[model samples]
Target: MLAALVLLLLTFALLLWPVAVTGGIASSLSYCLSALVPSLFPFMVLCGFAVESSAALWLSRPLGFCARYLFRLPDCCAAPVLMGLIGGYPAGARGTSLLLEKGRITEKEARRMLMFCVNPGLAFTVTYLGIGVFGSPALGLRLFLSVTLSAVVLGVLSGLFSPLPSPDKPGAERMESRPGALTRSVEGAARSVLLMCAFLLLFSGLSALLHEAGIFQGAVRLLSRLGVFTPNQWAAMLSFLLEVTGGTGDARALGIGPGFFAFGLAFGGVCVHLQVLAMFRKPPIRPPLFLLCRLAHGLLSAGAFALMGVISPMENASTAPVMAGIYRPELSGGWRGGASLALMCAAFLLMVPGETGKSSLRAPGPKLISVAGVKFPLQNR
Candidate 1:
């Protein structure tokens, strides 16, 4: 009853402030076009391809040892970890869901993986936050490193403490490569990206309506009355909790610390959390566990970013090392070469445990691909 009342009130508010909602959506659309799509779409396609085409198994081989020793997981689990770290957000969620669907990973393992997976991509962190927000790619690089280190620590701790699962699960290591894998990957990625953008637009419009209704201002005033935070700080904090991209930008505009921005990136806001949850038919992890891990990740990233700032301050553009130069084609071999090197490093650090005793080269079963809520099997060629 209360939820329905809230919805009715929200609907009335939206009707009263359509212009604000439209403007916010337009801004979100511009952001998606210029930053979000460019940063995420290609990687989503590639990550999907890696998993669907059986490249994940082959590429993750090098990390098999680390996965076994550090994470106490199988070699196959490393693939989704890499995807989460590189492709970010729903990519990790999608990869984990796919693995669960295929029985490559157990539900418990998937829950454990969710503690550290579903991260913001390096491109979004370094390119958008670092260069665009702070005007220092080096700073963005530091923030990215901070976030990555925290996630790695979480994965290590989760692995070390959690009981190891049985190694020989049925249906594990039976993924088969099928024709049109690339096409399916591309199609799924497109659908996923579209869904993500839709969420962004929805949230953006809602945020604008709330702001227009003075809800945010009222909250800020309340916080100020309690002396919890300055109005600007409160506003930035609210933005960070609700939407990451806008929050980071607000943090910069409000003269909030880079650490705060790092926290936003790691926590990934409500917008990101919803996107991740939508990927699964049943969310593998509990809400309490998810919230706890998110808070832990946010704090850890902020602390790490603060430590980096003290050790090597990159606030000054003139003094900051040209870390973004590595992204330039002329200065570096190219993104492809850089990505290959990154994968090699990641493979060395991650792996999982399953399909024990199964021959690596055994003939596999048909692969299942899901797109737009429909599932079908692709026969192994």
Candidate 2:
């Protein structure tokens, strides 16, 4: 306890020092506030509720047989699997941990599912990469398909080949009975999101420290001397190695090819890996699995995109309009980003006691969100 308090004190001291003024801290804070806080918080809440409320277990019932045979996983894992595909990295980790806590799935199954479910979402692939970066929806779609296919291949192969291990704790295997399941789940999700934000900030500061120390510069100089890559390629590669999100942005700025962009996207860099590793703290899942799967996913995605480039050359999308000025209702307000954002915001706003904002949301038990003439109710049971 003393050590933990000391560590916390040291963390605050560093943030107070040169880190906050640096661009790294600024960028990380900007990302969390503008994008991650609003975007991820809602999904995190929903995911938490999904597992605690038996929503995942209820949904996975019908698909049990297929999931068992095809994926070599118990039907109970279907929730996390689906969440992982849609939610991306750490969603699977979140789900796995949840299921493990519930005793619905063993630690081995959860670990296997972790490798299986993690992937970038359609929004990141299509909206950010496709339209925002490459300026071509087609290129983004191609990258998305490639990454999905690669993840599927890995999951299937691992399912077939790997043998199961005993649960981490033999007796504590299903969800335990507890009061305030809804509140607990929501709080759990909130905690997870906050933790992720912390990791991002820490990584950003560390990256800035490394940069100021000339570590990245030295790496670029050494790599350049190898004569293996051009200046632009080296820049893109270096940025990609340092921070996944910023690296991809740099790679795109350098005019790196679609295949390489896909590679960086799939690789998700060390920043993302740290975010994921942070999620698995309670369960004691292996950290190395996340790293291994990412490398494999990156290689497979890059190869696929490269092959596609050779077969059907991407048109010069340089002239394509940037995504910022466009109205992409499909990408934004659609399932991937928009709807969930609304629901999450509603959940959060309505959570404040006696502050439902209006008479319509002032229900005693739960809240309801009406969209397109349909009512979706949020409740504990």
Candidate 3:
């Protein structure tokens, strides 16, 4: 059934030479070149660097208390959760997988962490969703805050419920034995960011194709007739389900509501989930459970948005003004600059964990982050 539908859409697109297809391509390109590159690519690079830097190990040290007691996991688990929320998507997955590879977390613990650790980052939310798409920073902030709370609650619950890993399990190979890490991190960050950017472009194109195909319109019309929502509301909801970036854009166009936006964000689009699965290739993940969690999380976010809408006396979502933001390819230094400074500080702070005494200079040097005598390599394993 699905395949047939896809074939029909493709045939129609090819035969009709629809303008919506072109608009999708143009819109995606424009958004990527303008908003995504400036807002997200840098953050992606920063996340990559964070993964490779000794930051993870050092970060775990300071937050070990919370990890052991609050989250009920090893102290090393903190950074992954923190990184995942701040850096977005697979950063948390990557962090958890690294722990498994290192033998710091057992398979069980890693699976549990997977439940709550992953999410789109604050920067991604604020930059792209809040500023670029909605034109309302408040909307973006609400999405970010609501999602953050959900992840945190889920993470804590995951920690409390999941059993802790046994201390006796062997750790991954010692860090010193691995190749130079500094170079690897830089390369890894670049690779991850580029890969992510490619996916965004692909999905953007997909979203446009669907819109031009009339599926979205058809669904919205059908949905609108239900008498519960307007065509615009249905349009936004359907767009969100199909492609997050495209869906959010449609939601913005229709002025559905912030609840829809929050729901869309929590669902994180199929594009992001694919990204998560791609990143967690090794030791096959349990898809059913993950999908269930994603569904629950999205609904939870929607509820939060609705609750906020009720409590706040702000303008209705459809009526609120969207503050326009300009994006420049050049680095003239404003929020981007401040964000860079913050990223640097975070990376620096993450470096604080480990055996305190080895002060090795950056580049070609071995930056070892030792956790309880185990050296966390800077190299991408």
Ranking by lDDT: 1, 2, 3
lDDT of 2 by residue, 15-54 (tens): 6557332666677788778766765666666667667765
lDDT on C-alpha atoms for all candidate structures = 0.75, 0.67, 0.64
Q: Under the 3 Å rule for N, CA and C atoms, how many clashes does model 2 have?
A: 5
Worst 10 residues of 2 by lDDT: 372-381
lDDT of 2 at 366: 32
- Clash-forming residue pairs, model 1: 63-347, 67-351, 73-352, 73-353, 74-352, 74-353, 75-352
Report the C-alpha lDDT of model 1 over 1-381, residue by residue, as the tens digit. 999999999889989988878877898898888888888888788767766776766666676666667777766777778878777777778778777876777888889788888788888888777776667778878888999889888989988776664443323343466778789888988888999999999988878876767676677667767766666667778788898877765566556667677788889888888888787889989887898898899999999888887888664543122344456455346787788779867765444224655444445663433322323332110
- In TM-score terms, candidate 1 sits at 0.79
What's the true lDDT of residue 211 in model 1?
70
Q: Which should have the higher lDDT, number 1 or number 3?
A: 1
Superposed model 1: Cα runs more than 4 Å off: 164-175, 226-228, 316-381
Cα TM-score per model: 0.79, 0.72, 0.72
Off by over 4 Å in 2: 1-21, 162-180, 282-285, 310-312, 319-381
